[model samples]
Target: MPFINTSSPHQQNQSSVPDLMRKVLLALIPGALACLYYFGFGVLVNIVIASATALASETIMLNLRHYPVRRYLTDYSALVTAILLALALPATVPWWLTVIATSFAIVIAKQLYGGLGYNPFNPAMIGYVVALIAFPQQMTQWPVPQPGGALGLLDVLLLQLTGTLSDPAILDAVTSATPMDQIKTGIGLNRTIGEISTGALFGTVAGRGWELVNLLFLLGGLWLLWKKVINWQIPVAVLSALFFWSWMFNLYDGDLYSSPFFHLFSGGTMLCAFFIATDPVTASTTHWGRLIYGMGIGILTFIIRNWGGYPDGIAFAVILMNMAVPTIDYYTQPRVFGHQDED
Candidate 1:
């Protein structure tokens, strides 16, 4: 008979990969619903398509790698990645593009690096960046939210499948520049922040509909924190650094810069701060390192949004910080118990 050896301090626990992923999915619901309410049914469609694609890709990759497909697939990590990528994408993105992005995320970014716990970067951000670079035209044209109504369900599905509308004229009227894009362009044209922010797209804080979406994300993030799924340091550091930098710049020249509130509630700031930057695998393991990691992302995000070519820079900033996580963790390693530092 063979004997099994067990490690010391072994104890049963309720926590698991699937359970954690499920909680994350639940946490994302409020924000997704907010998007659906403000954007349209298209958001749900993207989620469904992306989820299916991610599952299929995960299964195939597992088989090719000689891993037990069912065991790995049941964890739901790939599904969460797909959902995050879907939420990050434009509501009207074509089905093929969504498929491509989701596939790349699971196959290349996740599995190629040994999947889930081993992946050094956020897979969703990688897929998003790839899609954005490959299909700039479709990726950037986010649908404008109508005051009373958004795109019809059938119309949204049609656009996603075919990338065209039955009534071409409707496309022109329904699509408008995102608030971030408008700000960049307006500033480039030498318009003061005050003058440009007065457009219909601008709200008291951020973009008209976007601020509400961000608020829901903030609520969801709080739920994650309450559930103890994530530490508070990363989100606090990201938001604080971004707010401080934006305020400093705005104070320098009120006309040249937008307020910190606008920066907080606009684009993907809240989402990145709460969810993306807090990825355990890619983030710092030590307490102090997490704060520094988050601060780096926040400062980079601010610089890219203000000075880089892209209107939003959270994806780029997160990737850059992911590269530094190894070094950060090495230096910030927690002191071992029963050991003293040597002089």
Candidate 2:
């Protein structure tokens, strides 16, 4: 009789929540590799430490809430949250930064609203925004992608753990500038795009290495689209809207507003467009809603980059739009079939 109950109409969807989350984690690999190549081994170290910390915090919180610790921890939400946060953060950020941010992300931003699906904010972005707000200097210390061995896992771990780095000199200089920072500062000082964009900025980007890294993420994003892991509506919409606005502004005054490519490859444009905005729980499920949600993010991203205090707008924009998901879904809901005039 219990087996017969399996045929009941109240069965859950075939695709498990855990399975979807796993696929998202897998999609991050190519982009992560690109980031590692550009930034250094520090990113890899960040991933491992952050993920481990996320798991531990998630376990502890689950226990505190009297939830099934083993089952939920194994679901790997914490690991994904850690990975995304690690990706967003600067390589040379201190170890405690990761620990505190990861804990807050998993506990308050995620579980406090009644665990994963119930949370309104994206866990990774929540943590990232908090870190950025609390420690602006550390969060902004992005690294340049050098030709040779810029970083190593063990070296970073040593620095993180003991504060007695193997080569303290090299470790101290590991930080580099992000493309957005370059453009923002350049434009501020009345330096033409050609002046400040010298080092990594020479090769068709504000930061040379960063352009390629964003390119790799774009490729991976397309791959996700092809695999149907994410819908194209959001990414394409976000990118296009951003480009259109940036282009218009640049045309109006190239001195103040940056070029369209700067808006595209700079900061977390590609990654956020594809990954964060596609979160099913936080994003609208309806097709039209997806397009509108994406447009909102893109508009906010451009506005913030141009005028907001932060150089990057992805985290703030995502969290803000997350609050509107319910309204986006409600109006975008498709009418029930064969209900015409039947109500």
Candidate 3:
């Protein structure tokens, strides 16, 4: 009998990819729950629709490509991507919109570039950008949380199945514009930051109950860091840069800018910093590279939010930096064990 060689020439490093992916899915639980709490049944419906559509599309695409659908589909990547896309979108986005975005994420952004690790851009972010561009009205509209009246899981499923959230007229009336939209409207009206904060436009820590949701995501993110599934460099650096820059700008001109808290807790900052920006494949691999990558995201995010057309820039910033990951990694490679400097 031939002897088996279990050991590598040198000790090898390995971790279960599926387990790590599962942890990431687990890490998202708090954020998802918080989103559901604040946004209501619509969020629940979005996940069901998006996940189902993503998996179904994955199976179809796998068949078309002549690949083993079970191997890739069971890896749980599609589910993770689905959850990310669903979380990023407005909870009340139509079922068809979720379907389109999820399909694009798995098909065009992921598989077309070659599956999973081969894709250059974050697949979910690609989907989100496409949806935002194609249906700005659908993506930007947000619903006010009903507090005590959130739907149970079964009810949410029914809502997704039936394509209605109770009475249609009431749904249309209550689905208000997001804080960003409100701010834009205020700016168009020549209203100052102070003027928008009063009355119905209360920040609610960036919108009613959104800050609380953000805090939960932040908490879960720290847990991920502690678990060693993610590094702190990117998230800390990104958030710090964003918060500091916003504070400085707001202090310089109170009337012109939203406050630091608003910047910290609003839009997709928490989601991007914790879940999206920390994506291992697209983000920097080296420690220094990660800092550079994250700070770049933070700066670009702030710049875009202030000067670019979109009120939230986290997704766009992430996609832009994903494009530069190779360069960032190339330049910032760590010194090897026995390498002499070019000097």
Return the top candidate by lDDT: 1
Could you tell me the C-alpha RMSD of candidate 3 in Å? 3.2
Residue 251 lDDT in candidate 3 = 93
RMSD of each: 3.1, 3.5, 3.2
List runs of model 3 lying over 4 Å from the truth. 1-14, 149-168, 201-204
Candidate 3 clashes between residue pairs 3 or more apart in a chain or in different chains: none
TM-score of every model? 0.95, 0.89, 0.90
Which digits, one per residue and each the tens of the lDDT, describe model 3 over residues 106-149? Answer: 99998898887888989999999999999998787777655633
Superposed on all Cα atoms, model 2 deviates from the true structure by an RMSD in Å of 3.5
Backbone collision tally, model 1: 0
Which 10 consecutive positions of candidate 3 have the poorest summed lDDT? 148-157
- Per-residue lDDT over 1-343 for candidate 2, one digit per residue giving the tens place of the 0 to 100 score: 3554456568555767677678778888888888888777778878987998899889888999999988898777788889989999887778889888888899899989899788988999999999999999888877666743366767766766665677667755765557677777777888876566665434674466667767877887887788777898989888998899999998998777878988898778888998888887788888899898898899999998888889899999898889988898998888789667435
How accurate locally, in lDDT, is each candidate? 0.90, 0.82, 0.83
For lDDT, candidate 1 versus 3, the one ahead is: 1
Clashing residue pairs, backbone N/CA/C < 3 A, model 2 = 142-176, 143-176, 200-208
